[model samples]
Target chain A: MEVTEDIIREVEKGNRKITLDLYHYSFNVLMSSAVRYKNHKEDQMEIVNNAFVKIVKNIKTYRPGTAYFSWIKTIVKRELIDDFRKNKKYKELFKIRDSDSVQESVVEPEVYESMDSESALQMLNVLPPATKLVFNLYAIEGYKSKEIVEELNISYETVKWHIKQARKKLKSLIIENKISLKQ
Target chain B: MKEEKDHIDDFFKERSEQSSFEVPDSFLDDINSKLDVLDQKKKRRGGFFWLWTLIPIGLIMMYVLWPEDIEINKTKPIVSLENQETNAEGALMDSMDEQKSESILISDSLTEENITQEKPLNDTENRSAEKLKSLKNVLQDDVKKIDKLADENNPLWLKEEIKKQEVFNSSNSNNESEIVPPEVEEMAIADSNPEKNIETRNSNINATENAEIEGSETDFAIDENVNNVVVSVDSLGNSESEDSIINNEAFEIDSVQIDSLPTETEDQDSTLNVEEVDPSETMLAGGNREKGDKINHEIQLYGGVLNSSSNLILSNDSSTFPMNTMESNLWSASFGVMYRAKIKQLDLGAGLSWMKTGEKANYGTNTLEMAEVDSLIFIGWQTDSVFNQNTETWSIDSIPLYDTTTVTTYTNDSIFYNTANKYTWISIPLRFGYRIDVNEFSFIPRVGIDLSFATGSNTGTYAEIINEGLTQNSSSRFILSYALQLEVRRSFDRWHVFVNPYFRTNVTPVISSAIQIRRYNSWGINAGIGFKLK
Candidate 1:
């Protein structure tokens, strides 16, 4: 069923069924980007539940009849970022051992067209944590390069490099999967 | 270069547009637990607020009912006490009677008319209780002064009464409440036999006997003796004054008004406005989901029979089956999964499906001719007579080049051959449809595009039109098709049973050539059921 303003009000009040439905919706929406370390067996459910807890706590701050999804997405993203900040692996993934690591070329544009959304998301997650975060913010989440730079607190070069690496990683994965451009 | 980059962006856009996704089942349980916690918190908060609200009301009641700053009148009426103990008892009886009068005033004040209307708020009900209490205190004070008043003359008692009646006089001037005003009290006493004034004093001698009936309206049993004194003195026949004292049952708990009634309509109007209480107003345990969950695409699996016809029929005889098209009444079955979206009554879908479009057709002739023969010509009889000129006497000399009994034989007779053009394609269809519901049934009308690509195909007789004369073999295998369908569906729980009748025509000819290509139009009537799995 389509969620409406009234539904959102009910959802806020902790109406069990409506809240559950709303949570499931939020979980699915943010899971792909939020649960980055899929191979590490990171619990997407736990991350989403925590995000929901935050959402419930701050639901009153949300304006009725406003863009609820965008507001929720922001909260979910923050929760994911908090998780990343807490995880030691996330820190290691981005720590520069040397300043001169090889940077790959931009991915072939046709590669994205070829893969289905599920496979594409999986491929997207395979990128290094910093690169995946930058790419998702820029490409899927519609954040600008400047905004990402500020958000990640990285220099312009590193930000651009991460975006490039994310694309290259996806392009490589597409080639590995042997899928071609399909309409 | 820019266009190529745009293509990449478009790819990402399309991929990201697939936002309607599935999640793990346990997430729902997590949400449920969070909501339960939220509900518990909400309940606690609500109870807390209610408790807080009650405190103020409770405090106001206490403030009104508290026995605060009650002072007794010191100077007393110089009435002679025949016996000291009996005067004390009479004083107690008068106090009890005043208490009853205070109750009646309280009840009168609490009526709906008084509560709702504010003009009369501080009228009879407001000061009557205070006056009654003051009157009770005066009776007590009078008892204490009885010994002193006893020393004075009996005539001085009435004169002293007249002299020190300032409070009663003030009550008559200030209060319009039912407890008798001074004028009425005086009139009742004046009409009374002045000879019975002494009798009035001794009649309430038993007032102190049963003062134990406290906090009860039925203290009327003890109040009767006191009432007789007033009733006998009330000889002016002013029954209303008598009724006032009789009706004044006084307070069961000595309650007092905490606040004045609000006279304005605005407050009442505001109260009415606040009644639209949201039943679902709950303190949320978790964040709310955005209202952007679209009509999500579902994975649907449906299989049914279909009949299809195409321009490319394989036939030995080319006239009836022009361009060697695929014939009609060809029953074929198909099954495929669709990314389906249902919006209210509207149903939308796109899917990849495969089906064959052909059946075996019969045309005569077993002979395989390299070049097709056009026609056969007959010779005139005069042509053979040229031979007769040379032999005028040699009559009919073998009809010249052809003799009289000449017979011509053709190559071969047409045979009953069985051959068919079987073509199969992987078709992708996008449909937009609306469903109308009636009871347990729904009628759906739909229109969409079908892009059919050749996946597995057999050329049939089109292969037969080879190098000898005709040589065009279509290399193009993609077809852009359109369809119209009507589906009647019956839903049962999460499963739906439907029969869809559809007609499809390829916008791009099945035979893509600009030349004499025939268009393929096909119809399918499928009966299938789909389970809703989200």
Candidate 2:
């Protein structure tokens, strides 16, 4: 959805409800990202607040041609990555691998689809930040593992491995919860 | 397989679509309140920064208002009374001169009369009578002059002068009248003759008065001029016969005068004597009086007891037990204040502390009972030697080794064996000890008994499965036992670091059965640093 000038003006003029509505939208996006990428709630809130502040400050820079949602998504992604780097948790997720094909079988669609979105997100939150980021990009966002590698400055195989591990943990959680599913 | 894959995909997609996440209510309120507080703090910071600037000014005002130097003045009175007595003595001497002139005139008139009477030789008897009367008049004039001087001046001074005159007169009288001595004897003998007796009595009275005056003067000089008068009196007593006669008269006169004036002089002398006596006695008494003060100020007594033990040590042993094993290291510390009594250089104190040791060993051989079981041993070993830098490193190779033999053989070739193993006991050390202080540092060496309690049991046993006959199972048995230990600690301020190498022996045998297990006594070293609370 386009963030119209009217909405921007209303937010900047301190319209409480309008500002809260805008904030709520951004908060949801950031909270989703935090749940999908950071294990510690305290650290996730930090990532979310950082993304929200950037969005609030730079929202005026939103141009006509650019997709606003994609722009917002990009900001959230970048913030999450920055949070990972700042905390030095990124290294814990990715390891050096010689072959990209070695990690291909690790990520399974059934594991991701087996649980409800909220449950899957909660499971994702438990993953190391970099691994969760790689899993979100490769599996949920449907980005190619190589594209994820480029976006995150990581090896293609590391992206594949993170997706595989993320799916495996999600599968374990599903089994532990004993949630009935169609499969 | 394709149908199953499609079904699984459908199942997950459907579940994902139904899931939703909601923010907790408390979280939103907490965030809003935090933001409000942050804004308030930001606003107040401006005022707070300005307020902080006044702190240094306030401190400067306090410094200026503080009191400056304090002044104290104390005064005391001065005492001395030597000038008053000298003035009184000078006034008495002037009165004596007036009396002496009158006596001289009387004597001169008597001599003139005697000459006039001698010219009328026709009345010879009257001339003799006149001569005797003139002689009597001369003697009476002399007596009058002496009495006037004695009454005017200090009696002691007058008596001294008269004794000298009497010595002179006696010699002259002896020369002029060879019979004077005989006559004087006859006068003394003629008690019936009232006139002669009266003359004798007057002479005796004069001599006694002189003696009394002399005694009083000597006593006064002895009391007032201690060193000089004592020397003079000694010399006078040692002088020749004539001098002795004079001194004897003076002494007689002094004694008489002293007796007569006892009411005034003795009372004053006694008062002065008492005053002088008390201060000298107080000085001597004060010398010993400070002993209580010295004891109160000079002695300080402090004492405490400290116990320190090593927390952990690691060791490896084989043969009797498992072939490879690891042990944990443990240490403990306890400190307590002791009632300390210190006299001069010696210090004495008593204190109590607690200690504990945990250790375990595993045998490689699997027994029939343990054949299907897998076990892991968590070994904790601690020694007091950790604080000792000079302690010889216990070579891992030097640890005592023991062997075990199978007591029972089974059909499966499994054998049961027992081996001896020794473990250190946990100790609570109570020490009554002392330390010598050298400079600011103290070197303490203490001797105390370690009251060790059996905390845990350690036993080593060798065993094999009955079916595995060819496979010999060697096991070491461990049973917990208690022993005594001795420890020494060196302390610094609140931190005490020490190393204790202890000897521990098993109080009970490893195996109670037929096969005697050769148990090795375990000797370990431990060291640790501890803090004192009191």
Candidate 3:
């Protein structure tokens, strides 16, 4: 349903159901973009809040007919990037590995059967930011490596390399946890 | 592998699962209450704005529409007082004329009865006596009526009554035989309205008698009264002609009195007169006097130590030529004194300033950075300029550079560097500026031409490089520079404390033998504190 002034009024009047509904809609859109970029739920909440403040403050600047979710998604992505820059952690997390000059091998399908959904996500969180973003955009969001390179302003080779590294890291994390469980 | 794909896809799906976001109930309540207070404040402010605007408008409308009625109300009493004064003077004259006519009638009656009543001695005398008694009775009765009318109608009756008492005392003692002649009496009787004439003549006679008795006591009063009457009559007849002459005489007398007054008293009284004086003329005189008192003087002592990394006088192009990093922080202080004369708001000044800037830098790439460069530029400039709060334009010309430096470096495993780069030159900086001021703080942006003339023989080893510097290649050339300067100052009495920040750019090429060693531009930022004493 379209949100109107009446919905805002109802929300302001302590109508829990309506306020929660609208908030959930905005939160879902923002969380999807944040996880796609960073693959970690730990920092996702802070990034989403920052994006939410920007959206609320500059709501008038948002043009309708354009994709509302994507517009909010871009803000979440920018906020994450800004946070990394401010902390001086972007270089460490995204630095290209010397060995991964070309695309690395993708994880085999057999590996997925061994882990549940929750375990798989736990493994994805441990992957580095560049690897995680590349994997999410390529495997999950169905973006091509060339498109990812254009969007992130990196070389096509860098995109291919990040995805391969992500798969290797996730597969190793699952295998290491499995061995621990067996022991 | 298919199961692995399914697990990864399920992980993404699980991560994407959205949770509801709920705003705290207290936050909305707090915002609504704050908004209510804001609305109240806004309403109050809007009311105040309209109230402020309406009061002056109402006052102005009242002044414009009601001025004529207000003026008439003020002038009405003054007009009435003038009329009262005029009427009093006319009544006094009329009474005096009536008194003269009455005296003549009395003399005529006395003479006519005396001539008619002459018979056998005793009888004739008795009849004459009775007629005289009857006439005395009529005169006494008429006098009583006049006294009653005077008491009821006249404000000056008390003074008149005192004069009448004096007249009665003097006339009672005067000669009794000066009675009216028959021919004169006949002429008086022949007048058309004899009875009225007789009464008027009796009043006139009584007035003459009063005048004679009280003449000494009332002389000043009578003279003043007569003069006022004559002036009032003349004024009424041809007021413009008479008023001009009277006003001129009055003005001359007033001026003499004013001139003789003490100057201090006149000055004190001038404040009172200011309201009375024409507003436009007073404003003009006040403005001129203030302008005449305008004076300005400035003294600046700006001394600071500035440390900079390099003497690389080239613009930084980060993509191409890397910065020649250096470590040198030079400290310099300058003292300047300026005296300005202001004509109205315009200021003209001349100032002398002295400054010394020195720097040392390591030149060449990392392996070749063994060479150290040292230099000093001593600047002495005398400026002639004009400045106001808005704008300033100045011309400065003086000997600028006297430098001594040594450089040593290894090239191809052998030492090669210039150790001397000392020389003197004159630089004239003609600057034009505009400033914007907030409170007393100002931002001044300036553009200028730096004209340099090499004065002496190039003594430094870097003279070759200097000759290779574009403008220095010629004996004289121009360098364009743009600068933004901000001066923050607080003026206290005659002294001012100020901090100035200056950023300057050079826009001319540096050349040596048609080869460019340094580019034509350089940028520097300097901050210093200074005081103004005037």
Candidate of highest lDDT: 1
Give per-residue CA lDDT, model 3, range B1-534, as digits (tens): 334434655555554543233434543454345445544665787798688546644643443355443442232111010122232333343343244223223322332223443353477756755665565455445444544565566646435534443443344346324443453333233222323322333243234433432211000011121121111111111112111001111111010000112332222111101012233322331122232232333434443322221233443333222323322333444343323333333433333333322233332322122332434444444343444445554544442333333344533332233221222223333444444556656454555444433444432222222112111233223333344444455656555566655544444433233222332222333344434332
lDDT (10s digit) by residue, model 1, range A44-145: 777777788888767767787677778878887777667667765654565554553443333455455557876765676677667777777777777766
Question: CA lDDT of B455 in candidate 1?
Answer: 58
Q: How close is candidate 2 to the true structure, as a TM-score?
A: 0.26
Badly placed stretches (over 4 Å) of model 2 are A13-16, A63-68, A96-114, A126-129, A168-183, B1-19, B23-534
* Stronger candidate by TM-score (1 vs 2): 1
For model 1, residues B43-114, the per-residue Cα lDDT tens digits are 998898678546544643443354422311121111222222333433343334334433443333343323
> Which ranges of candidate 3 are over 4 A from the true structure?
A1-21, A32-42, A58-71, A85-92, A99-114, A142-147, A177-183, B1-534
RMSD of each: 32.8, 33.0, 31.5
Candidate 2 overall Cα lDDT vs. reference?
0.40
Q: Candidate 3 clash total?
A: 33
List TM-scores of chain B, every candidate.
0.34, 0.23, 0.28
Interface RMSD of each: 11.1, 9.6, 9.0
